[model samples]
Target chain A: MDGTPGGLSGISAPGRVAAPDEGVTEQELALAARNHGLPLEALRYDVTPPGLHYVLTHYDIPATDADGWRLTVGGRVRRTLDLDLDALRARPATTRRVTLECAGNGRARLTPRPVSQPWLVEAVGTAEWTGVPLAALLAEAGIADDAVEAVFTGADHGVERGVEQDYRRSLPLSTAADPARDVLVAYEMNGAPLPPQHGSPLRLVVPGWYGMAHVKWLRDITLTATPYTGFQQSVAYRLRQSAEDVGEPVTLIAPRALMVPPGFPDFMSRTRVVRPGPVPLAGRAWSGHGPVTRVEVSENDGATWTEAELVPDPAHPWAWTAWRTTWTATPGLRRLTVRATDAAGNAQPLVAEETWNRGGFASNLVQRVEVLCTTEATAA
Target chain B: MDGTPGGLSGISAPGRVAAPDEGVTEQELALAARNHGLPLEALRYDVTPPGLHYVLTHYDIPATDADGWRLTVGGRVRRTLDLDLDALRARPATTRRVTLECAGNGRARLTPRPVSQPWLVEAVGTAEWTGVPLAALLAEAGIADDAVEAVFTGADHGVERGVEQDYRRSLPLSTAADPARDVLVAYEMNGAPLPPQHGSPLRLVVPGWYGMAHVKWLRDITLTATPYTGFQQSVAYRLRQSAEDVGEPVTLIAPRALMVPPGFPDFMSRTRVVRPGPVPLAGRAWSGHGPVTRVEVSENDGATWTEAELVPDPAHPWAWTAWRTTWTATPGLRRLTVRATDAAGNAQPLVAEETWNRGGFASNLVQRVEVLCTTEATAA
Candidate 1:
């Protein structure tokens, strides 16, 4: 409760360039304010800071002026090119530093919720990516051994419940043509360019997948042999229990990302309401998807679960994993829950199984929150 | 339910490594009874594949006939040094790759409702560490800013529940006096020499804690201001729930780890869950005392929770995160739980309140499991 949002040491900010959470420079970021926020000075990275960069691109705006931009390869292909950005700048381009989040960021927090883009819980970012290989242009546009999916169109507009929506997702054509594991097409980021709300000349980086399959302004690249639906596919990402249990979405990007599970927010005892004494149930867990093998804890709400001690961050296994569980605060009224499992056991879901569809994609489940504990009768 | 040994599988010669349902990696492996595999042998720049490289150390063995050895540093310091091995190889050394795991490599699956380490889970590996700075021998043993905690005693030996435990862990005197996060004593590893189960003529690497503060076979270093009570701090990393609600006992070494959520285990979902379709609930979330913000999921156990997609792979803050959720099989019986949260929100507890504790250190709670939902009339 102290990131000092108001623990105020004077509480009077007003300007860090225009602190609406910064970011507003690609020459003041306009397309009539692409969606607002544009003035932290075009951002380049100081650990992201610039109130965290911006770029959302998903609806037209593809006038691509990087020498007229091209990037289009053609279905399954035996050969059918388009290339531009000066033929992908004559091939070869590497740079990796990756990290990008935003598949509807937090999706209006969800709980049977819908209609989103409102994004918060930060929206998630981290860049460095530079491109070229779409599998060396799908081996000079010739890869078709029966293509097991690669679909992936994007220009972004929105409208899934009413139709229209133009952002797709599908992968696993061996991670859509690996190409030394870059998958790029990118137009540079973290070093500059590619701004028009992130997808200026071309996009689609696809490294570990899910940034909505790195679509953003990129246009067309079929390959298919199966799986790659519309409306972000079955209304974006997916995870609606009861269809006899789920798990067949997530076209390409792997690397599960999201955390905090381990006596979290435990002011004392699994948030035994919040206070009674020691409480530190804090949390955070991650693994680009293969390292976090375990992190479990719950306070009565989910009956019982305990197993926190998953430390791993040498140089970061794709990054993130921190934990702790200390409770002593047991007062009353608490509803805390935390779950995470990976090394491939998979867990996290308690509710939110409404596939109402609209534009909201893949809303995980099992995130209970309720806090307030007490233990201060000391001045006796 | 297919890990063999009663979990089925039987014998095999099928594909390679016996392949059979992803089972079969167990040839005893708790403390390696020998018998293991992976040798197609291929590497150019190496993305890990020396049988997955990263075995790490805190002493499992470090014997090769040692060319020489000494490396002492003396406690409460003013200058109680030792330095042999060629004056500690004439000062100055560095070779980084950093990655170590094994706080009991999965603690023998953490409870099928069991309690002693039979450890079949692999424990983890990854090498390339090189060492030198124990604050450069605690600044050649000059440390004494009233040191608050730096106890790392190890020569590795164990017996636990029946007593006999050596391997210690204790940090915090500002991480035993940081010098830009170094903390080593290592005597070469990937470049060779430093392998007696690993802790050769001295060890204590401490890159972000855990792996039990890298004790290994390295003699001692004690400077203490207090921390570390024993039994790995009272019974192997505890974290129970109920029974009065523990608050803190953990001998000294917190900052848990592990978060490899959904990325690796996909040979394309291996037959895509045998066709009954829909099943995307993945895991991995982390934070030892910081970063992983949110990764919620629960399908009716904690009643409700939905918030998964927290992709951060770099500025760990603490480290570990990779969460996913998309279940959809639907047939019957299935229970799971995961927990993690931090960036302050904290979380991770499904029950087992504070885990009473008589010995177990920090052992978190909330990781329920149960599955069985075949469908299609139990297939066809």
Candidate 2:
């Protein structure tokens, strides 16, 4: 496993400087230097820390070094075209605090789990990816429906026949124009030139999709009537079902993220002996789909349940929703259960999946905790 | 963010030595001293590790030096269970590797997310937990089938009116005897004396459920036809339908822990350049369910697709299934898609989830990937 050493853990850096993105005076290099496990040192107060900022590179960093960074568009287009860095930047630009997660971010958790770069959950983080939208670029190219897909190519190299590798990904023209997808051919990382570890020079930023689609070192673009079958396209980033059907197996999704809710601090099925006094049952709940509505705590394992008061935070939609409810801790073993409801009022499930795969990709079963009993009086 | 040492992260030990559980040697420690990342340094290679050892203390370790401990179980059983450590250990023992995961392990990832511990996928792990099965203990106690829920309590203290705390959770009787739901009153972890952090002395271990129900510091066992209404259960771990649902909020389940097959890499749109050499696609897949039977790969997103070779393990029903595929790298943007079919032929959903909770629980979408263009020469 390539343990890419970049956790917010044990690491040091130079002095602090002002960050262009959040208007915070923090040194970008130092912010990115915090080793894994310790996010506070680098993450500081920057809403979008420059160094710790996320970068979705296509392949490795580019070799162009910006001498002639350019983008080209062709095939079934009203206007075949090419644009340099200056011309690209001349176009309109926008940014938002979207979280970018490598599709393989948590893959390590799987047992007999293949080793990759040792990334903890921190591999997934929020960043203000800024760039010109692909739709605007497509408009410039005057894309057509016959062109079923818009292929993105990067300066990154992969050894095909042991030669140059140009990482690429294709999207449906429909998706390319959705505008809601917010796909971007980006050139900046948190208001700075992209770092080498991140995609340097230029890259594409496909929001809401796994990090793979945000090709790094972007260098080429093409429109195709049929889907492009590249190495990555034909192979990587896919999830398989446990069993197959008549002809072939099924294909999985775009991208999805999960969150924690109430019944959190105290996982389900835990046993605890309450200390004599009034205690609070609290937890946090949130979702990638939308905002959370309420979170419930049940000490009865789902028989009789209660609602915990949720702390409101409009600014924390992408963050966690904290909830609290007080309870009287009586003697003897006690059981607790917590669950959450989203703004859509969707609740969490209660069963572990019965499906099996070679790698445990998305194991989102009901979380359970086991606590035991004891009181202060037992000390005597 | 009192950090209160914080979720499973800040937990550490003094490196003190003590008699570990059965089969565990002082040199062998499984659970990590720092992170739950595997191949724990504290271990020296034994069936069980000393540090990763399980614990089920009847009292909170914070209130006292706590060497001598006592546990008591009462209610609905032929014989009430009350005894010190020695007496409890004297009971019959059984061993098994049950995966224990916190419902909040992936909690921090949700948007509009809740405030809770920052648990990574590592929040869940499998161990050869050794103990007297809670079923066996209950059998000895003469459990009553009329019992609705089997509630458990722990010694960890939760804030009470803004103070310290004790953690707790409970389970349904159906869940209690589920062969799939293996609950243990464990005295050994990985085959050694329980660590102080994990439940020590004796704790209730319920497999396949959220962590809360597997109460640590277990001192009591109560089987009641009517459930217990503690703070954790009534208010936490409950799932409501989407807020948009037109019915009264329901609390069925937000079952987590789904797995994808390994070598199940996702590929999205490919590039425009056609390359003529063989390229490889790889990934892994697994789920909380059963084993995988098929994994399909599509070079054209969901259009024309091909079946990849499936590889699986024999030992674990819960382990991931690894897979790989080979294809021609034609230069062009590629759309790579992969999905799994379980033993029952349950395919990975193209859009596994239609509903998302505020807590962002249960998100199982299809997997996709994109690749770049390669020339025949490069591919060759």
Candidate 3:
């Protein structure tokens, strides 16, 4: 994705600022930020801190004792093989920075929110994932030609649809074997061994796909000629567009962008009074479809659009790209809207209603930031 | 809904029990219980503790300075009156015990879980609410004959569906004025002034209705000739049965029951293993339609249902009724299911899939409790 840089440098100001909202006080913002596993304030840089990454788990973090941990490759393989943690680690390592997002990230913002995790737009983050290439391990196992899909299963298990089973998903055998896809059997995150909450000993890191495909606390890989009809695979993440439609299996993440919640830099302000003159807005944008090529900002409720300057960070191409824009301050309640376009031509929708799915999957709607600016007289 | 008391006395041995589930360990259960604002161990009491009541708020809780707070009655009313907290308390006071449940409760159990609050069955509790009857307040203001609905507005405000407005809902004037409905302008919860999280100073308590109808932090009562089409009223809580159906507004709580998550009294047990033979199970049952009259328990996945003994607690008509049953144990994995029938003849559904709503509202399916028991030799 390519974009012409605007004059405004989108970097956040030094120190921390509370999220912008008329209802939220500084104290509440701090608690909310802490609750989200991120600073309430937008970061000075675009790439999120590894520790601050958002976490969502259907089950508790598996207490994986690495000493006894093992990975089994079987099913349609020419030769079954089992490897321990050390064995997998010794076979050549690679690290890639990638953005991972929950499929239900923005589900709460949909016109009709479903009855599941009330995730806002914060259920996404980027991190450097280190592991051996999944393709390399698959090659060692020697997949049979008739294999159709590769099933990856995690240690986390729960009951769904009257069936009790571990969390599992299957990718087409061709996609699993594609070297360019950068599929990984990750054991490290951000240069550190994987934390328990993120998947302790081993996990799958599938770039470009939603987090569901990256099964955490991974333990087994089975290849089969038939498509796997497991709960999470065929039933859970289906993107049913309408009542009559059964929905297709959800895959790649959609293009999306988010601005730091607008707020005054100073905590002492009793009112949301923005200083008169040019106001700089900073945030991050990303796309699993492809790199974000352009991000448009709208101050008049999408009545008009202006391009924001994109901050190039080639080191983490799969991570979110930082962007900033300046707006002339006017004394009134202001609502800022943002939409991003990706290289794959997917654009964030103006409204989520059009993209409604039964399971509330892939809800990438235009983000809105509301701010109130008071004149000096009103502020006084 | 009435049935003859069964011989099995469902009284639970005193104290709390962990929820029976193969997947959740004791540690995870504690964390979950803490997150839900409930006691770490599920109790046998039919009435829920006020402090342990579950809470879910769309906007931050309003910091209410009670002295300055005022409730306004206007719109289609003949006279507009501004009443302070003292003025409300000065009027006739009434008390009622009501069970309020979030519409999104039991959402996580849906096979294709929606994206909202990951509420299990814990999103329900009964509390004794003391307040001034709303009908009396509306009478003082002189409701106009042309008024179609009485719209209630809370002080809390936020941006939802791209609009900045106070959280609001409108009830049909007939429903608001019906004395039998027992709608209240509540100021006290369980004999104490309302807690901030439960809506300080004033809130609405609509007995026999979903929690959404009980608007918290209430500030205004506006009578209107037309129905209120606010974000929460028309969109957020609408129970869309399918993509094709626009769905009706969700209201009354459904008939349902839940036993303490079956667990041992001692925390040392790593696995949920119970001694073989007669096992007693106890829980509470409720319904917004009317008092629960019958509760059925099944350990064989609905193959054979047995009646549970109901403890009569009719003093609090709106409160849940305590029930219990004993099941003969076998040395194997056991899935226990419970269902309740309300006085109005509404029964908890056998399958939530049939009653699936796009927003996942009013999901009151039978709860299944899974546990495993081993022979003495295997256990040793």
Candidate 4:
């Protein structure tokens, strides 16, 4: 970890633009090795298999004993409660198919490249999460009237940007107590006990929010009269313009669409090669702001757009909408792109640089795929 | 994918040393996003969970309809048989826990870097695979005396180095027909149907060999009188000293040991930090040559070594052996390394550069990790 030169100095530092020649730093590679994203082709599945779902862990997955694990709820509560797995399982369970995306999904595409996780557009996935509604637990614990925020603490402890702490995030008291929000203390993913990587035993599932708010290995929840100013909440995951100015906190995911890359990919360049004919292009689209209302495709890099058929799953409103279209590819190089507009009217930026920020949060740039159509017969 | 500057020209060109100032190219990042490696901390589990297992797909995960899929065994056989899922499932099934490591496992660690998948040491995982033995299938088809090799073809198709073709590889007739080898036409992984990324429906699982021999999405098996010289076989996955050197063909896995990186990691650098005390460290080790006979740990970067206790699972002979040791931590920084030796007398090289090759295949260099021990109380 020493003297291996590539990018900036130090283990964790404030965000900055990488030098023109600087390749991905070893630190970034280390993070990429531990975490993974959904393979874009996996967009074919409506309920992403747990293994195919994207994962981003801030620290080592803490070894946990499920039977002995307990969730403690205390601060500013009328009655502090400690609940084990069995106790939580005995409560009514709710399941929802939800899409989760990392706030830094398109960070690598940013021109200067935020010196963090160098993500492309693959950092999103959809899974069915099952657990007891968090609102029920708060009611049982009897939140105090003076409580203004609820801070959820996870068992995963680590350092980020030089600050050592347990991973923690807070929600406004109103949002935490709202039954319509449908937040859950998730214990299962895709019908099985959560795998260790997905936070075995228990975790938090905040619908329609970026992954940071859905803390894995959840251990405790504390209600506070004042805002929780932890590093994760106050410093990281924020959309900042520069070093001095405080930026807006990244929350709901912006609308975005990514296609299952057409044809087969070249092992190295990932340039798609398709036979000269009608190629069916399909993809998944989603938004945290609201349901995706329209999805459009462009074969000439967004010069002209055509609407695709949208098929939204009513049973899983929080999950992504499946869209499909057809293109008659000719013998030439083509750059294909896709974008989504939510019911709330927010659309993805045309390019990653449009949404660039120091922390590289929520840059839902439209996905562009390069395809070469040839008539030469090949082996298959 | 155009105009993205960083590395060498033209996608899928022959390997070469990257300039010192060159950062990871977008082409490499595309490959990294699609293929993922096992998380080091996941070593805590005996059988890595399906999702945690490392995956390297040569092309897109071909979508297969299990009910309609067929396995065709033809060419130089007494009888060409097309067996469907039901027909194959009716055959006697065998299950075994096997460890699969990519031939290019440590490619990224090499000095020049192969510029392929850019994998670190995490490109390995152990899983329980169940299916009918390949020897039984070959026996049923009745091999011809003149057949020198058995070619396995998969449904995955893509262009590599400008040649478009289906993914295919071949094994010697003797190796394919030897029941003692226990080669399997596997359909299940970790007690469940194979995940799409892992080759759904059916795939080949050859024990003791690198992952290339285990063809995924297997569709056809053709016997031939001559050795198969496909792109993946003759052009790629070969060890070469330079452009002109044909080099030895890569096969068996080399002995290697990787510890579960101790303590919590900083998000970006992954530099581990631990409290000053006795720290218990554990990891998994294995080799294609034979069972790991010994594991040694070095806290001062190989200045001195200490033997660790080895625990091999008798039931899973082809899987990795577990090893553990404890280190007394002082208040400072330390470089820790681990190496393994197999019963076959093969040992890992001390440095990655010692095993460097043009293709970056089978560079099982020793594992090195750095840790910081501090007495200061932190937030967590």
Candidate 5:
């Protein structure tokens, strides 16, 4: 327990990069085996089925019984509220289609990759989350004037970077109390009870922010007088260029676009193969800064771009926007790329190196696909 | 088209081994991200929820429209029957808790690992699948006398090892016609319409065979006069010792046991930590050969073993058996392991090398966990 960070032994320092050419380690593979990401092609579904939605569980999906679960709201609150599942369900509920993207979405593509979950994009999904608003719960509990942040603690527990504690994260009181933020104590996903991998009994759904802010397997909500300095909040999920730098906290997801890889894919390389003809290319675009205003596609590796048509869905303003375009295919290998720009003027970086960070957070590199078009009448 | 194994360029050979020092390739990582395994801890549930169930999709989870989709029974059948989702669900529905394990469950751990979806021990799950029996459907379709095999085709199309085709595999006509086999045309998982990833519209659920036999996104069932020699049937999923070996086809799941890793896991290494005391260890064991008759635990890395008590569930004969044992722990590092033996006398090998093969199939090595016990009252 000496000065070692998190007081654990045999743990790597936070944000350590793997040596160049070092492949994904067993540790990273173990994490990958436990967690999963959405298949880019699943974008065809407006609301991703819960099973296809990406999942990132830092610890075990705690075995929970909904009937026995209780959520306690306390700390700097005027009146602490302890409620059961039914009690919480009795409140007026609202369902919102919200998109959630992992802060470390494109981590593996980063050079000198940060050795964590090793995600290569695909860490995004949108689902209809149903629950009572967090603002309403806060109102019921009656927040004290001194409360500055709302710290959420989940039931799942494990040691990360030597720190042994339940998974926890905090939101500023300003964000938590704002009704427009649309944060929720979500108990259901896609109209069904939350699956075990998705925090089962109850969880948090913070629309328009990176996934870390939306805590799962929630057990307690404590209003704090001072800012929460937990490990996940103060040390991890930060955009830092170097180990010594105190970086800015990663919050909203950066603007990003991903095309459903056109045509059929090769099993090993996943390179696409298509028959020579007019190829209809379609994909999804999203941003937390604001609604995605524009989406562009490039068939020649970003040398030239064509503005794609955006299919607006007024019902799901917080979910990803659908975009489509047509590409006339001749016989040759082609690199296809897509990028999105949000109303706030935020656009995805053209390459991974541009958004490089020690922790690999907010890496919204443009999505690229290698496609081969052939004249063969029957080619997969 | 040149003499490449599957007529595809830049694709690795069917049974190629990755360089020993090379890390997991981006392509393998992409496959891993798209597919997922159950968290070992999730074994605590009797019936795994649909989202927690393991999935291995050879191609895209084809965007299936249940209303428009149809299942065709043709080939050597007396009458080719085309049925919609409603037609399948309207038949006598039977629900059974079946456990499925990928043939390549422990592929990643093999030395000179197979260059595919690098799975560990998590590639197994049990769910109550609801559907009409395949025997019933085949009986109604009236298989012709010459039919020797029933080839099942899924809608998912892709190129594998240079060969382009829809995902297809076959079962012996005898196996498909046996009512005792309990093969099913599954449309629901855990009482819900199958999730897109699990196979929407309809899927094939072969009760005791390896997951490869359970064709998902089912499109057709063709009763063939001769045995089907498709790529997935004849080349892939075979247990071969060398590249040239024709090898035996992998079918039934080998007996294996996996412990719900004791205590909590370190975030990076996944090493278990526990306070010094009597630690209760529990896990699930299953086999395609027969009901799991015995389970054993080893605290000293398989040096000595003790039998564990098996909790039987009469309803789920094809699902995993629950086993538990208690260990008195002192402060030190210990390697814990578990193995299972089925009624047919099949047992898990002690080391992975014993089960290694060129294609990395059926590697049911014993499950091992490195556990650290400490005197500290509060250690994760």
Candidate 6:
């Protein structure tokens, strides 16, 4: 056996040591291939732009022309300024890789799934966002001490919660003006001009917050003395702790992990079966609140837990951490689940039922998988 | 079972089906965990900085502080300019994520492994490189038609092939001045200043090329009227096609695929055993010459092949593609192998013996892995 890259020796070399046993069904071999490492089809693993971006607008996207696009900063500011696309691009541009996830990403996992956009975990993605920092523009406008919030408005208009309005959300003035936050008015995604589905021309990207804070098709930024009680801010994304509790606006993404489903593909294809043996599993874990500190996998239905290996470098402070583990098999069926814990000591729940709200948001549940294994005799 | 994210309903849910006959042993359960996915300790998989970076230097790294660092441009130029780190940063800066690999990576796999920094597959890594484009710097110095190549010299000096000189390599003048090539005089790695081992203040990063082209601790750029015959360029990295052939200078990386070894961990730990059934495997595929188009995995010693799923978005034009596949098993030792085919039609060979160089560089051999699978009865 040859030594590994790290100088570890005595490991066996790769190649066939034995042939397949006689009468092993052709279907079984295909099944093994099909059910291989994490199912790509089931996961939104793409971190680059222009891939499968989770579209969840209240209305159809409005076609915006670059010439017509303008960003206006007014309200509780010393100066009201209107700038075109070119003007914004002329500013000092900074690029950062950030992970954005829908606040309602795992809503479909709820028993009585919400009636709105039915999203599973695939609604999350990461990309390189390049543009002027929002703090720079806000600094030019000069904020008033009385301003409590900064409201961001998009061009897409629709009726929501019995109110006709453009898509808008507000951030606390502190979050809007904090340079360390790295919030940006983004015009590019993954080094290319933003696609129509992702905010084109301009969009407000509040890094470390859920997707709602990223107001796409951005048109205006308004500061106000009181908090903006917009439909999206005060109504849609509120997370209720219990039936009697008044919900609070959901902002940061909780610690969460999703294993690549077995047999994940680079592209969609037919399903394959699995043989019973040593199965390697992998997935990504992330937290909007803090860097993920640990991830654990449960093979006996969460009865006992073991730590999974986390990819050390988290690309970005806000990007997801890749992880892996294994599940040995017995010839029947088995359930595999994964949980994540963040630096803030927040651990993902076995079931995300506790965070369920009227809007069915913030479901960081322990994701589970079930697969069948067959013995050689039973298969043949 | 609920439908997968892609809305495919035919897939079955995961869980236990039936109990195995009185044979399966507890050791098999441990095997499942040990070979979980990509043996982290065995490979360098850091996508972020401060992780394991492959180091290969002929001499001691020259400790040059930024205060003393000066880049000089001369030879065949209308203007010779010497600039320091501060002056270099004054120019427009661009950041790109690119993968870098040693030309001698996988050199350990050669039949008669050459005497050098023995690298297996783990000598490769990807990082966000930030710096000013070399084209901009060259444009300032102006080039003449007589200039055929630009020689880049690093601070380290050593004796190689009976000559004592600083590390140096050259690129064609056209390639050195092409902005589309995305070459950079990189000063930062993964958002932070370059670490001491990674070139400290400055390095030359030629995207889509082997690590030898990235001259660390860069100090001088000399425009040459003819081809460079430096020891490194003439002897070390030359890829000889055959005994009588004059090997050309190696530039782009070949198509290669590496699977995360079963029992991969964040850190090295005890080896685990395997059960009898299906096993899932995954790894990364990449090519410096072109984007990886396809990857195939062979579980039965290469008797038959199956297409493994590739990670859809490559994140960068030059980044590696993630892939996965599965193996159905009978209770015995097994060998698994993976190969990558690039858009250029360059496929990894089953045996890399043909490409073996006297210096043992560029070994894209079809990687083989050996594993053991035991039945409950035999294992117990």
TM-score of the second chain for every model: 0.30, 0.61, 0.86, 0.96, 0.97, 0.82
- Specify the highest-TM-score model's number: 5
- Considering every candidate listed, which one attains the maximal lDDT? 5
- Say which prediction, candidate 3 or candidate 4, comes out ahead on TM-score: 4
Can you write out model 5's per-residue Cα lDDT over B226-340, one digit (the tens) per residue?
A: 8998889888989899888999999999999999988887777888878788999999999999999999998888888999999999878989999999988876678898999
The candidates' DockQ values read 0.01, 0.02, 0.01, 0.50, 0.54, 0.02
- The candidate maximizing DockQ is 5
- Could you arrange the candidates by TM-score from highest to lowest? 5, 4, 3, 6, 2, 1
lDDT of 2 by residue, A1-380 (tens): 01112211101121121122221111111111111211211222224343333332322233356767778889878898888888888989966445555554433233333222223233445555677888888988898768888888766553321223467777777767678767777777667666554565777776555566777777778999898777556543445432131112112211222222112122211123244567755544445445667666665677876777877666433444556777665544455566666655456544333322332233222333333323432110
Count of backbone collisions within predicted model 1 = 173
Candidate 3 has a DockQ of 0.01
Question: What docking grade applies to model 1?
Answer: incorrect
Q: Candidate 1 on B289-362: residue-level lDDT in tens? A: 45667766665788887677765656322234456666655644445455666666657656542432332334
Cα lDDT for residue B157, candidate 5 = 92
Clashing pairs in 4: A23-B23
Task: Summarize candidate 2's per-residue lDDT along B102-147 as a digit string, tens digits.
Answer: 5544332334333233222224345677887676666677776566
* Candidate 6, residue B143: how far the Cα is off, in Å: 54
Give me the displacement of residue A77 in model 5, in angstroms: 1.9
Q: For residues A205-292, could you state the per-residue lDDT of candidate 3 as single tens digits? A: 9998998899999999999989998868766788875545668988888988887655431111111235457888778888888889
lDDT of 5 at A157: 87
Q: Model 4: how many Å of interface RMSD?
A: 5.7
- Candidate 4 chain B weakest ten by summed lDDT: B1-10
* TM-score of candidate 4 to 2 decimals: 0.96
Identify the runs in model 1 with alpha carbons over 4 angstroms from their true place: A1-72, A76-79, A82-128, A132-184, A187-220, A223-361, A364-366, A370-380, B1-75, B79-91, B96-99, B106-123, B135-139, B142-210, B215-231, B237-380
Full-model lDDT, candidate 1: 0.47
Per-candidate RMSD, Å: 22.5, 22.3, 19.3, 3.3, 2.1, 22.2
Q: Which docking band does candidate 3 fall into?
A: incorrect
